[model samples]
Target: MDPKTASNLSFILNKPHDVEFKSRDLPTLSDPHDVLVAINYTGICGSDVHYWTHGAIGHYVVKEPMVLGHESAGTIVEVGSAVTTLRPGDRVALEPGYPCRRCGPCLSGKYNLCPEMRFAATPPYHGTLTGFWVSPADFCYKLPESVTLQEGALVEPLAVAVHIVRQAVVTPGQSVVVMGAGPVGLLCAAVARAFGASTVVSVDIVESKLAFAKSFCSTHTYSSQRIPAPENASNIRALAPNLAGGADVVIDASGAEPSIQTSLHVVRTGGTYVQGGMGRDEITFPIMAMCLKEVTAKGSFRYGSGDYKLAVELVASGRVDVRKLISGVVDFEDAEQAFEKVKEGEVIKILIAGPNEKKE
Candidate 1:
């Protein structure tokens, strides 16, 4: 390829803690239903930083240089011949993952479980932290007039929370307890409230995060204690006694073993438990207690089916405001600094500006 033929500038992760800016060849529509987007903003996810510093996530290893972002929004500069919902100059959020539509899970509307899913920023798949990207037109959600591209980039995490809340089956007049105060956790609490949960409690080990949660979405916050898991569960129940036995739904977004243990114990008998955080591959589970209480335990992966679309509607309607979760934004050239800040635990959700636009 000639040097002049390349115009897609991207931040490539060459190895652990090593990233370089390079102009990749402009991406093309791989299928008749695909669309090309000019990336405008990209958010830093924990998984993104992990890949940048570890060169791999689980079995997904970086054997070659790969682009470095997935949470993103961009302008659709070109659409495939079969695409109809989008056209040139449309602003939309990139879902960043596409599964094989030929699988049983895909047919069942659970494509997130498809074994052949090609997720961006994972091994061998280029991410969206670039000037241009290509994705299926169906995965690209157009931003309404009420939403901004900065907010559009947040649809990914919001979709994760939506899926978690959906798995938990959160309902009106119920109490929901969310473990962890990160972006996803906070969003989970918010979505639960939007789903009609009467009381939302956010639990975290950090007092500051809990404070932020109280102001952001949760009706209450619990700072973890050094006591036993059962006692912690009891104390959490004391914070919100609206539910009889305990919280109607318990979600673990922290992935910490202690949180997991307490989350299982915190759910009322016959209540639901959803694991949404990324922890170790294995942990000491309280299977017996869960069995005795008849707790329904479910694992939440990435968003699925109507998750992204619902997330967009939630944000657009102001039911779940993600703007408060944004800690800061950095320019595209300083994308490395954004990664460093997140690695150092200095920011919540920081976005990197694309070359096509300045700070929004």
Candidate 2:
């Protein structure tokens, strides 16, 4: 261990809307396959905000003083005896979820669904907001010289987009409409284009968000506030006649009830619809239209096998650029303030430097 590594400082959430900086024990490599990392950058995710403001997401509740953050990148500070793929000083993007390799889902190569999976920032599991995080060597991906630490932190979310696109089997010469102009939505659009979608339309209530989406990879932008939910599909079709025939797929990143309903009306017959966003646990669906159109609706979770690797390839190959989506990068002391901006919809993606505070 480095001589500077004594104790660790972390941002902890005592409860809903209550955050504090606390001294934490320096993590040691307990398993031979584990690698201890000095966290360099951690992105503020929407789920983190949901936990901060609501104290829980679904069954996961923050009853204890849990550390908050998951999208993170760092350098290996120490490696266990059995680890060989990475060593100290190696830059890496830490994959936050690691499942028991003996589980049914693991055997089936869908480890993201493993029942015994433990994910960072989830209740009862401390996250990567601290100075040092210990993760499995296999789960920590080495970053190439071309990818920055900021881009590395973003790979987590980008992996989510990759999984969603893969689920839908996005293909060439197809028209895709993505609802919501949030960070994930924008990335989804970018990935859709990288996946060979002919036309990509982004829908949002905010013009600034739509503009941001267009600036990235959205071929067309629509303001949902101006168009009523009932007329969204029609207006989008009229605006882009090539898309008038109906979108080949619709990915809802907004998770709004209206967007969910609009998806049902807009997708072409036998089209695919993937829910990339999370909103109400239960919402009304246009089952009749769905059944009649034979639209295949699928829900996407975090990420699974081969997703993270592909995300890194997308960045390394220069096929998908994530830096444009970064709105700000703040110091560890200002993390709470950054989360406040997320709550107010003031920023797209903000990365908080680790407690050690190193710039790359």
Candidate 3:
């Protein structure tokens, strides 16, 4: 297959806010286990915005023109010879990353940590933010009839939340605090509740986002901007009286240093603390306090095996309402506006459609 033969409408990041829609040749499946999909909807992610603005995320730099977007859902248009689980016309969510299955991490069922992961829209890999894309059949989960393509696109982010909740081992009657009311944070709160957490508190700087968090599944919402930061432990206790009383688990989805610091201060002794968001490579952690409380702190990257499947189940079983999180949908041509909305932090999730988009 020649690179010139692929047909795609890519949002090329030439400059900030400058998106180019190019028509290239269609992509072909190289491996017998691969499948070709006609993408219908792609969700604008924060990482996509980061790449658009800074042109780099951590060590992954966009040195050349690259397609943006990873959260996507589509219908199978073709399948390779060895693929038996999926067929043409199957509606599915494309798990954007494909890891080296022969690696140690893959054998240990932690493929998300595989060092040779080819994640879409991340760098050196084209993304699914186009009309058609190719991926391994195993990475694509078939969506149930009840789930729409939009909901299928949401499965990508929901999978991250699912993985975090599983890592935290959230159980019934446990009190959970989610610092950050972004899309992932809201999804985490919803999944935690589905996993039987008795109480879920979402803290964010935006009151509107906090209000939106309540609509999904959070038991309580707090605006940290409204509550000034404390100068000492006494002030911290006063600010988060309910949480200072002790939380069984704290998930930092904001990636902000302050939120990470407060998570340690508010979590109960022996509680679990999980970092679900990415921020600076290094920060001043409360190591002494974490040690004193015997808190278990862990970092959650992208979703691992079975996370995407569970994410689809959560939506299909009506356990999590993903539609409420969708702020707006834009045509494929207006995809740039979707990114702008995300930059403005005015929407929870934005869905971009293809040329043949059908109303749902």
Q: Per the 3 Å backbone cut-off, how many clashing residue pairs does candidate 2 have?
A: 0
Per residue, candidate 1 scores C-alpha lDDT tens digits across 250-322 of: 9999999999999888899988999999988899978877999999999999999899999999999999989
Candidate 2 lands at a TM-score of 0.97
Which regions of candidate 2 fall more than 4 Å away from where they truly are? 1-7, 226-228
Residue 46, model 1: lDDT of 91
Candidate 3, residue 149: lDDT: 92
Minimal lDDT window, size 10, model 1: 1-10
Better of 1 and 3 by TM-score: 1
What is the alpha-carbon lDDT of model 3 when measured against the actual structure?
0.86
- Tell me each candidate's TM-score: 0.97, 0.97, 0.93
Q: Which regions of candidate 1 fall more than 4 Å away from where they truly are? A: 1-7
Superposed by TM-score, candidate 2 places the C-alpha of residue 263 at a distance from the truth, in angstroms, of 0.6
Order of all candidates by lDDT, from best down to worst? Answer: 1, 2, 3
| Error in Å for residue 77 of model 2 | 1.1
Q: Whole-model Cα lDDT per candidate?
A: 0.91, 0.90, 0.86
- Return the clash pairs for model 2, or none: none
Instruction: Judge candidate 2 at residue 319 and give its lDDT.
Output: 86
Better of 2 and 3 by lDDT: 2
